[model samples]
Target: MEKKSMKGYIYLMPALIVILLFTAYPLIRAFLMSFYEDYNMISGEYSRIGLGNYKDLFGDKDFTKALRNTSIYVVFVVPCSIALSLLIAVLLNSNIKCQGLFQTIFFLPYVTSVIAIGLVWSWIFNSNYGLLNIILSWFGIDKVQWLNKPKYALPSLIIFSVWKSMAFDILIFLAGLQTIPKDLYNASRVDSTPRWRVFWKITVPGIAPMISYAFIMGFISAFKVYNEVFSLWGGKAGPANSAITVVYYIYDKFYNSHNYGLASAAAVILFLIILVLTIVQRMMGRKK
Candidate 1:
């Protein structure tokens, strides 16, 4: 037994070493750097150690905007994505023709590159000569500047995010739906239960756990939004920084402005926000 345990530990050593070096070290280093006032990466020097970086971050309008935008994005995206995905998954799980094909089409976005998908969405959202504008024109609606205008940037981002995020949620929901015993559905059908009521009472309760999981994971990912903004705006946050997120703010401070201390502080704040939200989500799930 001891020999077997030693061999198992030996097999895990490489992965443990990699995690320590890459994940643990950087996390600890970032936390420490967040407290170092006026930290210089090249010189490894700081004027003092306190909450100066955090104080400055809150004082900065850009950081506050980023935080607000991130909060909005998460709040909108998580629910929208989950709801849409749940509906689609329920449909796809039903006995229908071309089910496999539909599933493949829906799941394609999950595997496709975000940049590639963003570029396609950009063309669709273009103010002039765009598919969306053309469709709206038929209904007598004027052209709307989705990408160029600051007012619409966050909405546009939310739309794209909800669409992009639905793929994974749909996949998870479909898997959960499959695990549900067919007998329950058959009994519902024999009793001639209304489809909507059956869905609410039976299907929903059956997949309640998957819904909770999706919401928890969705919130965590949505809080760290950066790639969608970058891809949609071509490496920019948004017009007038309307769609700026905490991750984007951190990147700007760390790389563009070379404000390592502020960036680290922002990263730490983001980590805490996600951690607290996740804990809350789990507690809610347990109570339910």
Candidate 2:
């Protein structure tokens, strides 16, 4: 037994080393750096250990805006995407024809490159000679500048995020739906229960865990929204930086401005926020 355990540890050594080097080391280093003042990346020197970085980050208008935009994005995208995905998943899980084709079509965005999708969506949202504007013309609505205007930038990002996020969510919901016993559904049909009542009483309760899972995953993903903004706006945050998120702020600070201490502080704060939210979600899920 001792020999077998030793051999098992030997096999796990490579993966453990990789995790320690890549994941654990970075997290620890970032946390430490967040407390450092006037830290030099090249020299690895700091004037002192303090909360100056955090204080400055909180005072900065750009950081505050990024936080607000990220919060709004999380609040909107998570619920909307999950609800839409659940509805579509329920419909597709039914005895619908061409289920495979529909599922494939819905999932294409997940597999496709975000850069490519963003480019396509850019054309769709174009103010002039765009598909969306052309559709709106039929309703006699004036053209709206989606990408060009600051006011509409976050909304455009939200819309794109919702569509992209649904792919994995719908897939998970479909899998969850399949796990629900068919006997319950059959019994509902035999009792001649109203479709709406059946859905509310049976289908929803059956997939409660999946819904919870989706919400947790959705919130985490939405909070770290940077790449979507990058792809959509061609590496810019948005017009006048209206759509800047927490990650974007960190990137700007660390790379563009070369403010390592401030960036680390912001990154640590983002990590803490995510950690707290995840814990709260788990507690709520347990209670439910």
Candidate 3:
């Protein structure tokens, strides 16, 4: 038994080493760097500044705006994505012709390159000569500057995000839908229960877990939105910084401004926020 246990431990060592090298080391280094005041580009030295870096982050206006924008994006995107996904999943789950083709078309966005999608979507949302504005012209609506205007930019990004993410949620919910026994629906029909009542009572409860999973995933992803905004707004974070997200703020600090310590502090704060929210979600899920 002792020999067998030793062999098993030896087999696990490689995986554990990889995890420590890739995950543990960077996290530990970042946590330590957050305590110092340093610029990666200008200075080679990292001087200890205690909690000063974190203190400065709170006073930074850009960081505040980024956080606010991230919160707003999360609020709008999460529920909308989940709801749209659920609806699509339900429709796709029905006995329709060319179901496989429909599933493939819906999921294509999820698998496509983010940069490519952002580029294509940017043109589609262009103020003039864009497909959307062209269609709106038929309704007597004027051109809308989707990316150039502060008010419309973030909402446009959210709309694009919802479209890109809904496919994955649809797949997840479809899996859940399949697990729900067909006998329940048949029995409800036999009992003369209305379709709406059957869905409310049966379908919703049956996919509650999937809905919860999709909500948490969507919320987390929306909070970290950067690439789309960067591509759509030419890396300026949209007009008036309306589309600046927390991750993008961190990127600007570390890469553009060379503020290593402050960037690490911002990253640490973001980590804590995500960690706490995830914990709360898990607790609520357990309670349910």
Candidate 4:
């Protein structure tokens, strides 16, 4: 037994080594650097500034806006995506005709290129003569500016995100549904239990684990949303940075302004946010 365990450990060494080299080291380095002032990117020169970077970040209006936007996006996306995906999954799992076709149609968005989706959505959300507006015009409705204005820009992205993200979540919920024993439903049917009661009492509780997983995962992804905003609105965040997420803020700080220290601080804040949310989710799951 000892020798077998030793062999297993030896086999895992290569992957562990790679993780330490790439993931662990970078994270540790970044955390350490977050305490310092703008350390030279080209040269290895640096000066310690204590908490100045974080203090500045908290006070910065743009940073505050980015953080607020990220929080709002996460709040909207996580629960909405999970609920919609669960509904879709339930429908697809039911004894409906052409269910496989429906599943394929829903899952297509998940597999399709995100860049392509963003670009296509941009065209559809275009202020003038876009597909959605064209259709609205048929009913004599006015064409609302989808991506240009602040009020609609973030929501347009959120709508697309929820639709695209639902595919994978639907798959997960479907798998969870299958794991539920058929005997429970049979027993319910034998007792003439109402469908709604069985769903709420049996089906939902049985799938609680899946719901928790999806919620936590969606929350993290929404918090880190960047590429979608970038691709959707021609590289800029929005009309006036309405869609500037935390990750995008970090990127802008690092690339656009060459403020590496502030970027590191932002990254650290994001890491802490994700970590805390994950912990809270796990605690709630355990309580349930």
Candidate 5:
């Protein structure tokens, strides 16, 4: 038995080593850096400053704006993505022709490179010659500067994000829809149940777990959104900091400002937020 256990441990050692080296080491370093003041460039001298970095972060208006923008983006994008994905999944799962083609088309965005998606969307949202404004012009509407305008910039990012994220949620919902037994729908029909009522009572409950999972995943993804915003807004926070997100703020602090201490503090705060939100979502899911 001891020999067998030793062999098992040997087999697991590589993965354990990789996790320790990559995940654990960086996390420990970041946590330690959060308490430091200035980062040494030439001599590598990092002095301890207790909670001063965190205090600076809290006092920073840009950080606060980034947090607020991120929160709003999450609030809008998460539910919209999940609900639209679920609807699309239901449509695809029904008695429709070319179901496989539809699935491929919907899932394509999820597989596409973020940079490519951003570039394509940036062209589409261009104020004068873009496809969106062209269509709006057909209806006698004026051009709108999507990336340049503070009010429209965040919403534009959210729209693109929802489009990009919908594919994954659709696949998840499709899988859940398949797991729901056909008998439930047939039985409901035999009992003279209305179609809508059958869906509300049977289909909704059957896919509740998938819905919860999609919601949590979408929420987390929306919170961590950075690449799209960066690509669209020329790597700066969007106009007037409208499209600035938590992760983007952290990246700016760490790389642009060379403020590793405050960046790590921001990361710690983000981790706590994600942890609490995920726990609350799981608890609510269990109750349902």
Candidate 6:
């Protein structure tokens, strides 16, 4: 048995070493470097700054905005996407005609390139010539700025995010729904259970695990949003930094400003947030 275990470990050695060399080493190095002042990205020289980097982040307005905007994005996007996807999954699971075609259409956004998604949506969201405003024009209402105004920028992001993120969750929910024994649903119908009760008591519990997984993954994705904003806003955040997120904060500090120490500190903070949230998600899943 021990020899067999040894052979198994040897089989895993290459992958384990790759993970250690890339992920673990960089993580440890960044954590240690976070205590120093901005390390010269070019020359690799820095001074010990203690908690100066973190302190600066707390005092910085853009950093605070990034945190708030990320929180708002996660809070709105995660649940809304999950709920919408769940509804779609249920509908698709029913005895509807052309389900395959409908499913493919819905899942296309998830498989499409992020750059393409952003570009296509940009035209639709254009303040002046966009189809959205064109439709509003028919109603005698003035065009509402979508991406170019701080007031509407975040919501525009949320809409685009939900549209994209819902596809994967829908697929997961559909798979989970299939795993549930059809006899249970049939029995509920035979007993004359109301539609809502059948859904709550049977369907909801049946898909609870899928919902848990979706929520956890969705929350993580939503919290770390960057590429969406970057692509949509052409490498900048939305108007007035409305779509700025913590990852983007780190990107600006490390890549743009060359503030390595502050970026590392921010990365550590992000890691902690994700770790805590994942743990909480696991606890809730176990409780349920």
Better-scoring candidate (lDDT), 1 or 3: 1
Task: Give the CA lDDT, 0 to 100, for residue 53 in model 3.
Answer: 90
Question: Over all chains combined, what TM-score does candidate 4 have?
Answer: 0.92
**56-128 per-residue lDDT for model 2 (tens digits):** 9999999999999999999999999999998999999999999999999999889988888888888888999
Clashes of each: 0, 0, 0, 0, 0, 0
Provide the TM-score for each candidate, comma-separated. Answer: 0.95, 0.95, 0.93, 0.92, 0.93, 0.93
Candidate 1: count the clashes: 0
> For residues 10-127, could you state the per-residue lDDT of candidate 1 as single tens digits?
8899999999999999999999999999899999999999999999999999999998998888999999999999999999999989999999989888898888889888888899
lDDT, candidates in the order shown: 0.92, 0.92, 0.86, 0.88, 0.87, 0.89
Which scores better on lDDT, 1 or 4?
1
Model 5: which ten-residue window has the lowest total lDDT?
1-10
Overall local distance difference test of candidate 5: 0.87
Candidate 6, 238-259: lDDT as tens digits? 8888888999999998889888
Consecutive 10-residue window with the lowest summed lDDT within model 4: 1-10
Please list the residue runs of candidate 4 whose C-alpha ends up more than 4 Å from where it truly belongs after superposition. 2-10, 281-288
Ranked by lDDT, the better of candidates 3 and 5 is 5
Candidate 3 global CA lDDT score: 0.86
lDDT of 2: 0.92
Tens digit per residue, CA lDDT, model 5, 1-288: 344456786888999999999999988978777887785645657776699888998999988988999999999998999989988998888789999999999999998898888988998999977898999999998998988899998889989999999999999999999998888878887899987897789878888889989888888878899999978877878888877889999999888988888999999889888898899887987787
Tens digits of per-residue lDDT for model 3, 152-242 = 9888988888888888899999999999999998899899999789879999999998888888888777778898888787778999888
Model 5 Cα shift for residue 25 (angstroms): 1.2
